[model samples]
Target: MTPDLFGRHRAVLPDWLALYYEDPLEITHGEGRHVWDAAGNKYLDFFGGILTTMTAHALPEVAKAVGEQAGRILHSSTLYLNRPMVELAERVACLSGIPDARVFFTTSGTEANDTALLLATAYRRSNTILAMRNSYHGRSFSAVGVTGNRGWSPTSLSPLQTLYVHGGVRTRGPYAHLGDREFTDACVDDLKDLLGHTRAPAALIAEPVQGVGGFTSPPDGLYAAFREVLHERGILWIADEVQTGWGRTGEHFWGWQAHGQNGPPDIVTFAKGIGNGMSVGGVVARAEIMNCLDANSISTFGGTQVTMAAGLANLAYLLEHDLQGNARRVGGLLLERLRSVAARVPHVREVRGRGLMIGVELTRPGTDEAAPEAASAVLEEARAGGLLIGKGGGHDTSALRIAPPMSLTVAEAEEGAAILERALRSV
Candidate 1:
């Protein structure tokens, strides 16, 4: 009754599905740092499924856990209690350092953020929420409403209650050409001015590292200072770790941790690697603040049996294997190699980000305008050379983001860097 796996169908895949993938590669299967297409040609995954793969693809332990959980149980109604769900909550809370905290789980980053928005607005009894410019929360109505990127603004603007404000940018090494201390101060001042002009904000959401804003790491003392400003105005600080969480940044378990003493976020949202490719996302809220939400607020698919099993296994694999330490060491080596290559290319403007979350910015030989064509050419060249990476920033100009799995080895990192360097030269 079923068609052959390789059999052609009269109906082709929907164009909407094609819209999600900008690249031409058709993935069939994946393993550690490698993906294969229908032709069975392998490509090294430097992008790590857009940084969602923390333990690498088809991780044996993670797969084993999922298999075992599938054999045992898969889903349950929210009205009933489940062991995997309960244990996952406890582990996530403990690791996140939110004591006695309540967790609301979802299936994606946007859903998690949307839930947070609902809870914040309902609990705080405020219709206004302030988000940083150049931010990207998600595509859903409420979550997209909070996003501040210009490209997404047209689709996001509506009767949705939200306010967009620019956050502190980066302008130095490891994070360059972004807003600095002066910018953060100005942002705070702007927020104060906004508060005076409009209603008190319910929440102030930001990415500790602005992943979509060209990997902009806020200036030193920025988050701590922002925390103070938000607290003074009785607004909660919501750290959107959708792209920066789950130890991808290395040296720290979460991106907010890199903010030093000033970056302790009040509420943190996480997805991507938490389930190691399973459908799962969650929020770890400060115990006191989380209590503001009423019991009526709940999600149906939150902490499904299979998803929790996968999350627990993924966290275990990361911790037991010291993936974070590996990322820190290998990422440093890779960055040094990139810097060495940049020294040869006059067009390479900067290299930024910490650990595995890195970005390479290319520019004109003597001007600030980026050569997007050159960057794209280099990307395609790298793909031809067997390295799969990603491009970011609004113009698609300079910023090339590289966020491989934490399990990537020193040797693999070197190989990826070497290929990237060669690709740059070819372009």
Candidate 2:
């Protein structure tokens, strides 16, 4: 019996709130890398709720931490001395690689980015922000302002004067045809030129791997090169590591390390996987920038004891088990397997990403034209074959995203790859 819940959902929820699939799925429960629909259909979850579930679903440590914290205190505002928050902050600061790093926790990535913008603008005394093309920061007014993707940015009204930068998406821009070194030089030249025209900007923000832009990234050390120019101009570099943090990229715990020649970013914002599903977002910055705001500020719900408890427990588990190493090993296997599968499919234009954060861009066969329809078809087909994935791209949602839990096993990777191959073939 088909439920009328979908009809009710449409009636109550705002239409603009995007849902996947023509028939949106209702996940009843999840365990490990798999989830069950309300109707009892089991599927291997590849996207892992946009890579928020860094570890496996229903991990015992996280569950115990949340459960224990709830038994004691659900939440205490920032006014209270929150032990768990302090502990987690210390850990994040140590991990952040920023000198004299201070941590400010928020409930979501959007709020974290908003706080970062606040600190950067206040410190530099400039409202001008530079962001990468095809980047999606968040939904807040200020975050959306720096977002360079037209499809995601809903309004032109912004308090900040934003300049869109190049090199975030290296696959299909005017400089795409250039070699890695050449592309780096070209993008650097472009940035210098853009900066010459604009007033002094507060900061330049970028994602090491653009999540919603279909896992695209510039050549290694591109940001390092840009950092050199920005440093000379006294502009801060803010790395939005919401998706790329926590060894998701395998080689680096933090995404900025790929461009670490410039040392740590002036400010870094992270969310999504740190809490392993708990709503934990935070910003890490040097003492100077963090202390710029003179007025009193506090996040009532930010750094709540319960969420902090969850974060501490989760981080402990991730490090103890060496999930970062697991990500590197298994992610390498998965990436190689995906490439093999994509090589056989003409519709698969490019397979890209680091670690489990992978994307297979779809295109009209033998052409560069994006094939969002083919991507959608592959998604539906994958779901039918008991596999769950995600789709995203700057060009009309033309890339299939695959990011399973960090604890993914060899057999599971092979299983998901087979299912994805079948789906691509069907499409």
Best by TM-score: 2
TM-score of each: 0.90, 0.99
Model 2 ranges off by over 4 Å: none
Instruction: Estimate, for each residue in 137-255, the C-alpha lDDT of model 1 and write its tens digit.
Output: 87788877887766554474653567766553455322344346557677667767877877888888888777766676766566677677777767877888888887777778887
Clashes of each: 5, 0
- Candidate 1 off by > 4 Å: 1-23, 172-183, 260-263, 294-297
Question: What 10-residue stretch in candidate 2 is worst by lDDT?
Answer: 1-10
Model 2: which residue pairs collide? none
lDDT of 2 at 269: 99
